[model samples]
Target: MSRLERTMNRYRSLRCSGIADELQELVAHAEANAVSYLDFAEQLAEREQQVRERKRLAGNRKRAQLPPGKQLEDFDYRHQTTITKRQVHALLDFGFIDNRQNLVFIGPPGVGKTHLAVGIADKALDAGYKVLFRNALELVEELELAEMKGELKKKIAQLTRFDLLVIDELGYLPMSRQARYTLFQLVHAFYEYRSLILTTNKDFTDWGEFFHHDNVAVPIIDRVIHHSSIYMLGGESYRLREKTTAG
Candidate 1:
């Protein structure tokens, strides 16, 4: 084999495939520019690093499961006047995640609660923080199933691995006893360790009714609100508005 082919094979074997793939282009550029040996090596390292960073971010985004097309720019502050552009933009700094705080959005359906939560989550993913998004009912059901399988603790551990957890559509439906208990366990696991972004339809007073028991709901609410920023998104439903306009 040629020396260049042998060198490319070596790079691939060392898991420097990014450098290996660009080897020909990089060599041509180096010869054209009469670049020093040190400069060429630095260029190769930079290319590899960039490629790896892109791959890592892509993987994190996939694992986050953020809803497609929900970004900060897509959020309509015009319809939902309760929250301002400045307030939402401030979250991009990611201090809340760094401080291990939570964000709670409370409002009726279709007021862009999920959109806001998802927008912030997408930003978090872009900022290199691990994030996971799930519907509240679905997450509770999953926890319940994990409990049934005697893997609740394991599941909780896996969940707590993310830097931020986005639980959408809380209080849209009532939770069963087992579901409430498991949900509490999962929330408790995340308390003070990682941040959470929650979108709920129910207010604080109505949480007891939503959970089916005041006793079980209180502790969960306490943990969720502690060190959290609560945003009340009030206005008519965006979906309803659109439907009416279409009609």
Candidate 2:
């Protein structure tokens, strides 16, 4: 490469800042004196600005990933036959929304509980909180797998870093004694410090049936509700609508 071009290539790679305008002056002087270097400095400054702009966009994108979807706005609270507007507002006002208390939504199958929980979680994420959504059965299985690999504790630590955790379908699967204990450990560690959004089709009275031990179920309920919001739901199955329409 020519001297001027070679110098410019090296300068661009260095990405030096605050040298562009100075390079213009130098280029002008160099042109008059038949010497080169100023143009190379200007090219480096331009490259630096380009790199910084790209980094800024990448950072914004990473932050945007925290909020998964816009389903919150379409939750259709008006269509939910069980929860009243007042109750919904109260939940938003509860310590759960402001102070990050855990929230448990208990109801029979087909209630709009998961929709409401996801709605609230979306709002939290929009407020710049980190969130993770998983089914209780899936998370329990994953935790068990991690335990077999001797990494359960590390996995729990990673889970705690999220500001909001949404665990749906808590009673879908019968948890073994070990699964119950591992889940208890996860919930206990997150107690009071982070927000947990749980949607369960089983009532608290039946929790022992899933856990398979009264001792574990009782204390888990006690700790979970100690500083939590309970939304007891009652309604027909939302799935019924589709069935009726199809008929």
Candidate 3:
């Protein structure tokens, strides 16, 4: 075998497949440019690091289950007058997550609550933080099932592993007593330990009615709102307006 082929085999054996894959092209470029030995080595290291970073982010995005195309830049600041571009841009730094603070977006349906929440979550994923997105009812149901299976603690532990948990469309439907209790336990476990981003259609006053139990709702609200940034989005439903205009 040629010397180049032998060197590539050595790289692969050392688990530097990223460098190995680009070795031929890299060697050619280095020789063509008369690049120093140190510079050539640095280039190889950079290629391997970039490849690993891309793979890591791809895996995290898959595990996050973020809705596609919900980036912050795609959000329409014009339609949702309540929140400005500036306010949302400030969150890009992600001090809230670092401080273990929550972000709660409250508004009527289709007013872009989910968009903003998911947008922030997408940014968090790009910043290398582990994130998980779930519809409120779906998350509660999973917890309820886990409770029945006596795996509630294990399930909550799994969820808490994520740096940020995004719960979308909360209070769209009333929860059952068992479901409410299960959800409360999960939220309580996250208290002061991890961060949460919640998009809800119900107000704080209506939470008691939505949960069907004031006793359960109170503590959950207490934990969620403490050390949280609350944004109230108010406007007509974007979906309805678009349908009307289309017609």
| TM-score, every prediction | 0.98, 0.71, 0.93
- 105-223: candidate 1 lDDT, tens digit per residue: 99999899999999999988889999999998789888988999999999999999999999999898888888889988988998999999999999988998888774879999999
Clashing pairs in 3: none
Over 13-92, each residue of candidate 2 has an lDDT whose tens digit, in order, gives 66643343244555666678765466555554565676676665555445434334435556556557566766665665
Error of 3 at 91 (Å): 0.8
Winner by TM-score: 1
Which runs in model 2 stand beyond 4 Å of their true positions?
A: 1-70, 89-98
Q: Which stretches of candidate 3 lie over 4 Å from their true place?
A: none
Which candidate, 1 or 3, has the higher TM-score?
1
Q: Where does model 1 exceed 4 Å of error?
A: none
Question: Which whole-number lDDT from 0 to 100 does residue 208 have in model 3?
Answer: 89
lDDT scores in order = 0.93, 0.73, 0.93
RMSD of 1: 0.9
Candidate 1, poorest ten consecutive residues by summed lDDT: 208-217
